[model samples]
Target: MNTKQLIEEAVSLPLEERAIVVDSLLRSLNQPESEIDKQWANEAKRRLSELRSGHIEAIPGNDVFSKVWDRFEK
Candidate 1:
């Protein structure tokens, strides 16, 4: 129904479901043609092209996360 009712219903949802609702709501607030989206799209395409052309190597997710944790974790 209205915003208040919608918010109350969303809050009553389970934690994971509430998080999905919040994420979707936040996404809706952004314009698809915004500069940020265009930049991300271009970056994604560039990464995909690089992977296909072998211009750069793709690191495993675990390796990437391990590097991040090694740098940031105490």
Candidate 2:
């Protein structure tokens, strides 16, 4: 089928199915890079290890956002 016909068929799908179709199309256009994913995983693991070992302290998300907004308003 042509593009117009394909779109009409997609539009007739149920809401959940339409969402899946949109997600699949988006993933096809923007494929993930395994190297970047691996780096992020390693960084997350390092941060968790530091927090667990008391080498770093976690800040409350609310406090962090409040500080950011305060600075932004200034």
Candidate 3:
């Protein structure tokens, strides 16, 4: 019921379950209008607009990953 009791119950959970609870609690503390989210949203819209207008072309995922793997292997 209280914060102390809730914390004690969480602590009694298995290690993996405790990690999930801690991650969920931490995520709940994040604000909706976080600065990074706004920046990323703007960037995503810009990329989408460019793609739609034929200003840029999307590369195949397999081609991109193959190039990356080749570079890393060297």
Best by lDDT: 2
lDDT of 3: 0.95
Q: What are the per-residue Cα lDDT tens digits for candidate 2 across 1-74?
A: 99999999999999999999999999899998999999999999999999999999999999999999999999
TM-score of each: 0.54, 0.62, 0.58
Clashes of each: 0, 0, 0
Candidate 1 lDDT over residue span 1-74, tens digit each = 99999989999999999999988888899747788788999999999999999999989999999999999987
Q: What is the lDDT of residue 36 in candidate 2?
A: 97
18: Cα error in model 3, Å: 19
Supply the global lDDT for candidate 2.
0.99
State candidate 3's TM-score.
0.58
Assess each prediction's global lDDT (C-alpha) against the native. 0.92, 0.99, 0.95
Ranking by TM-score: 2, 3, 1
Ten consecutive residues with minimal summed lDDT in candidate 3? 25-34
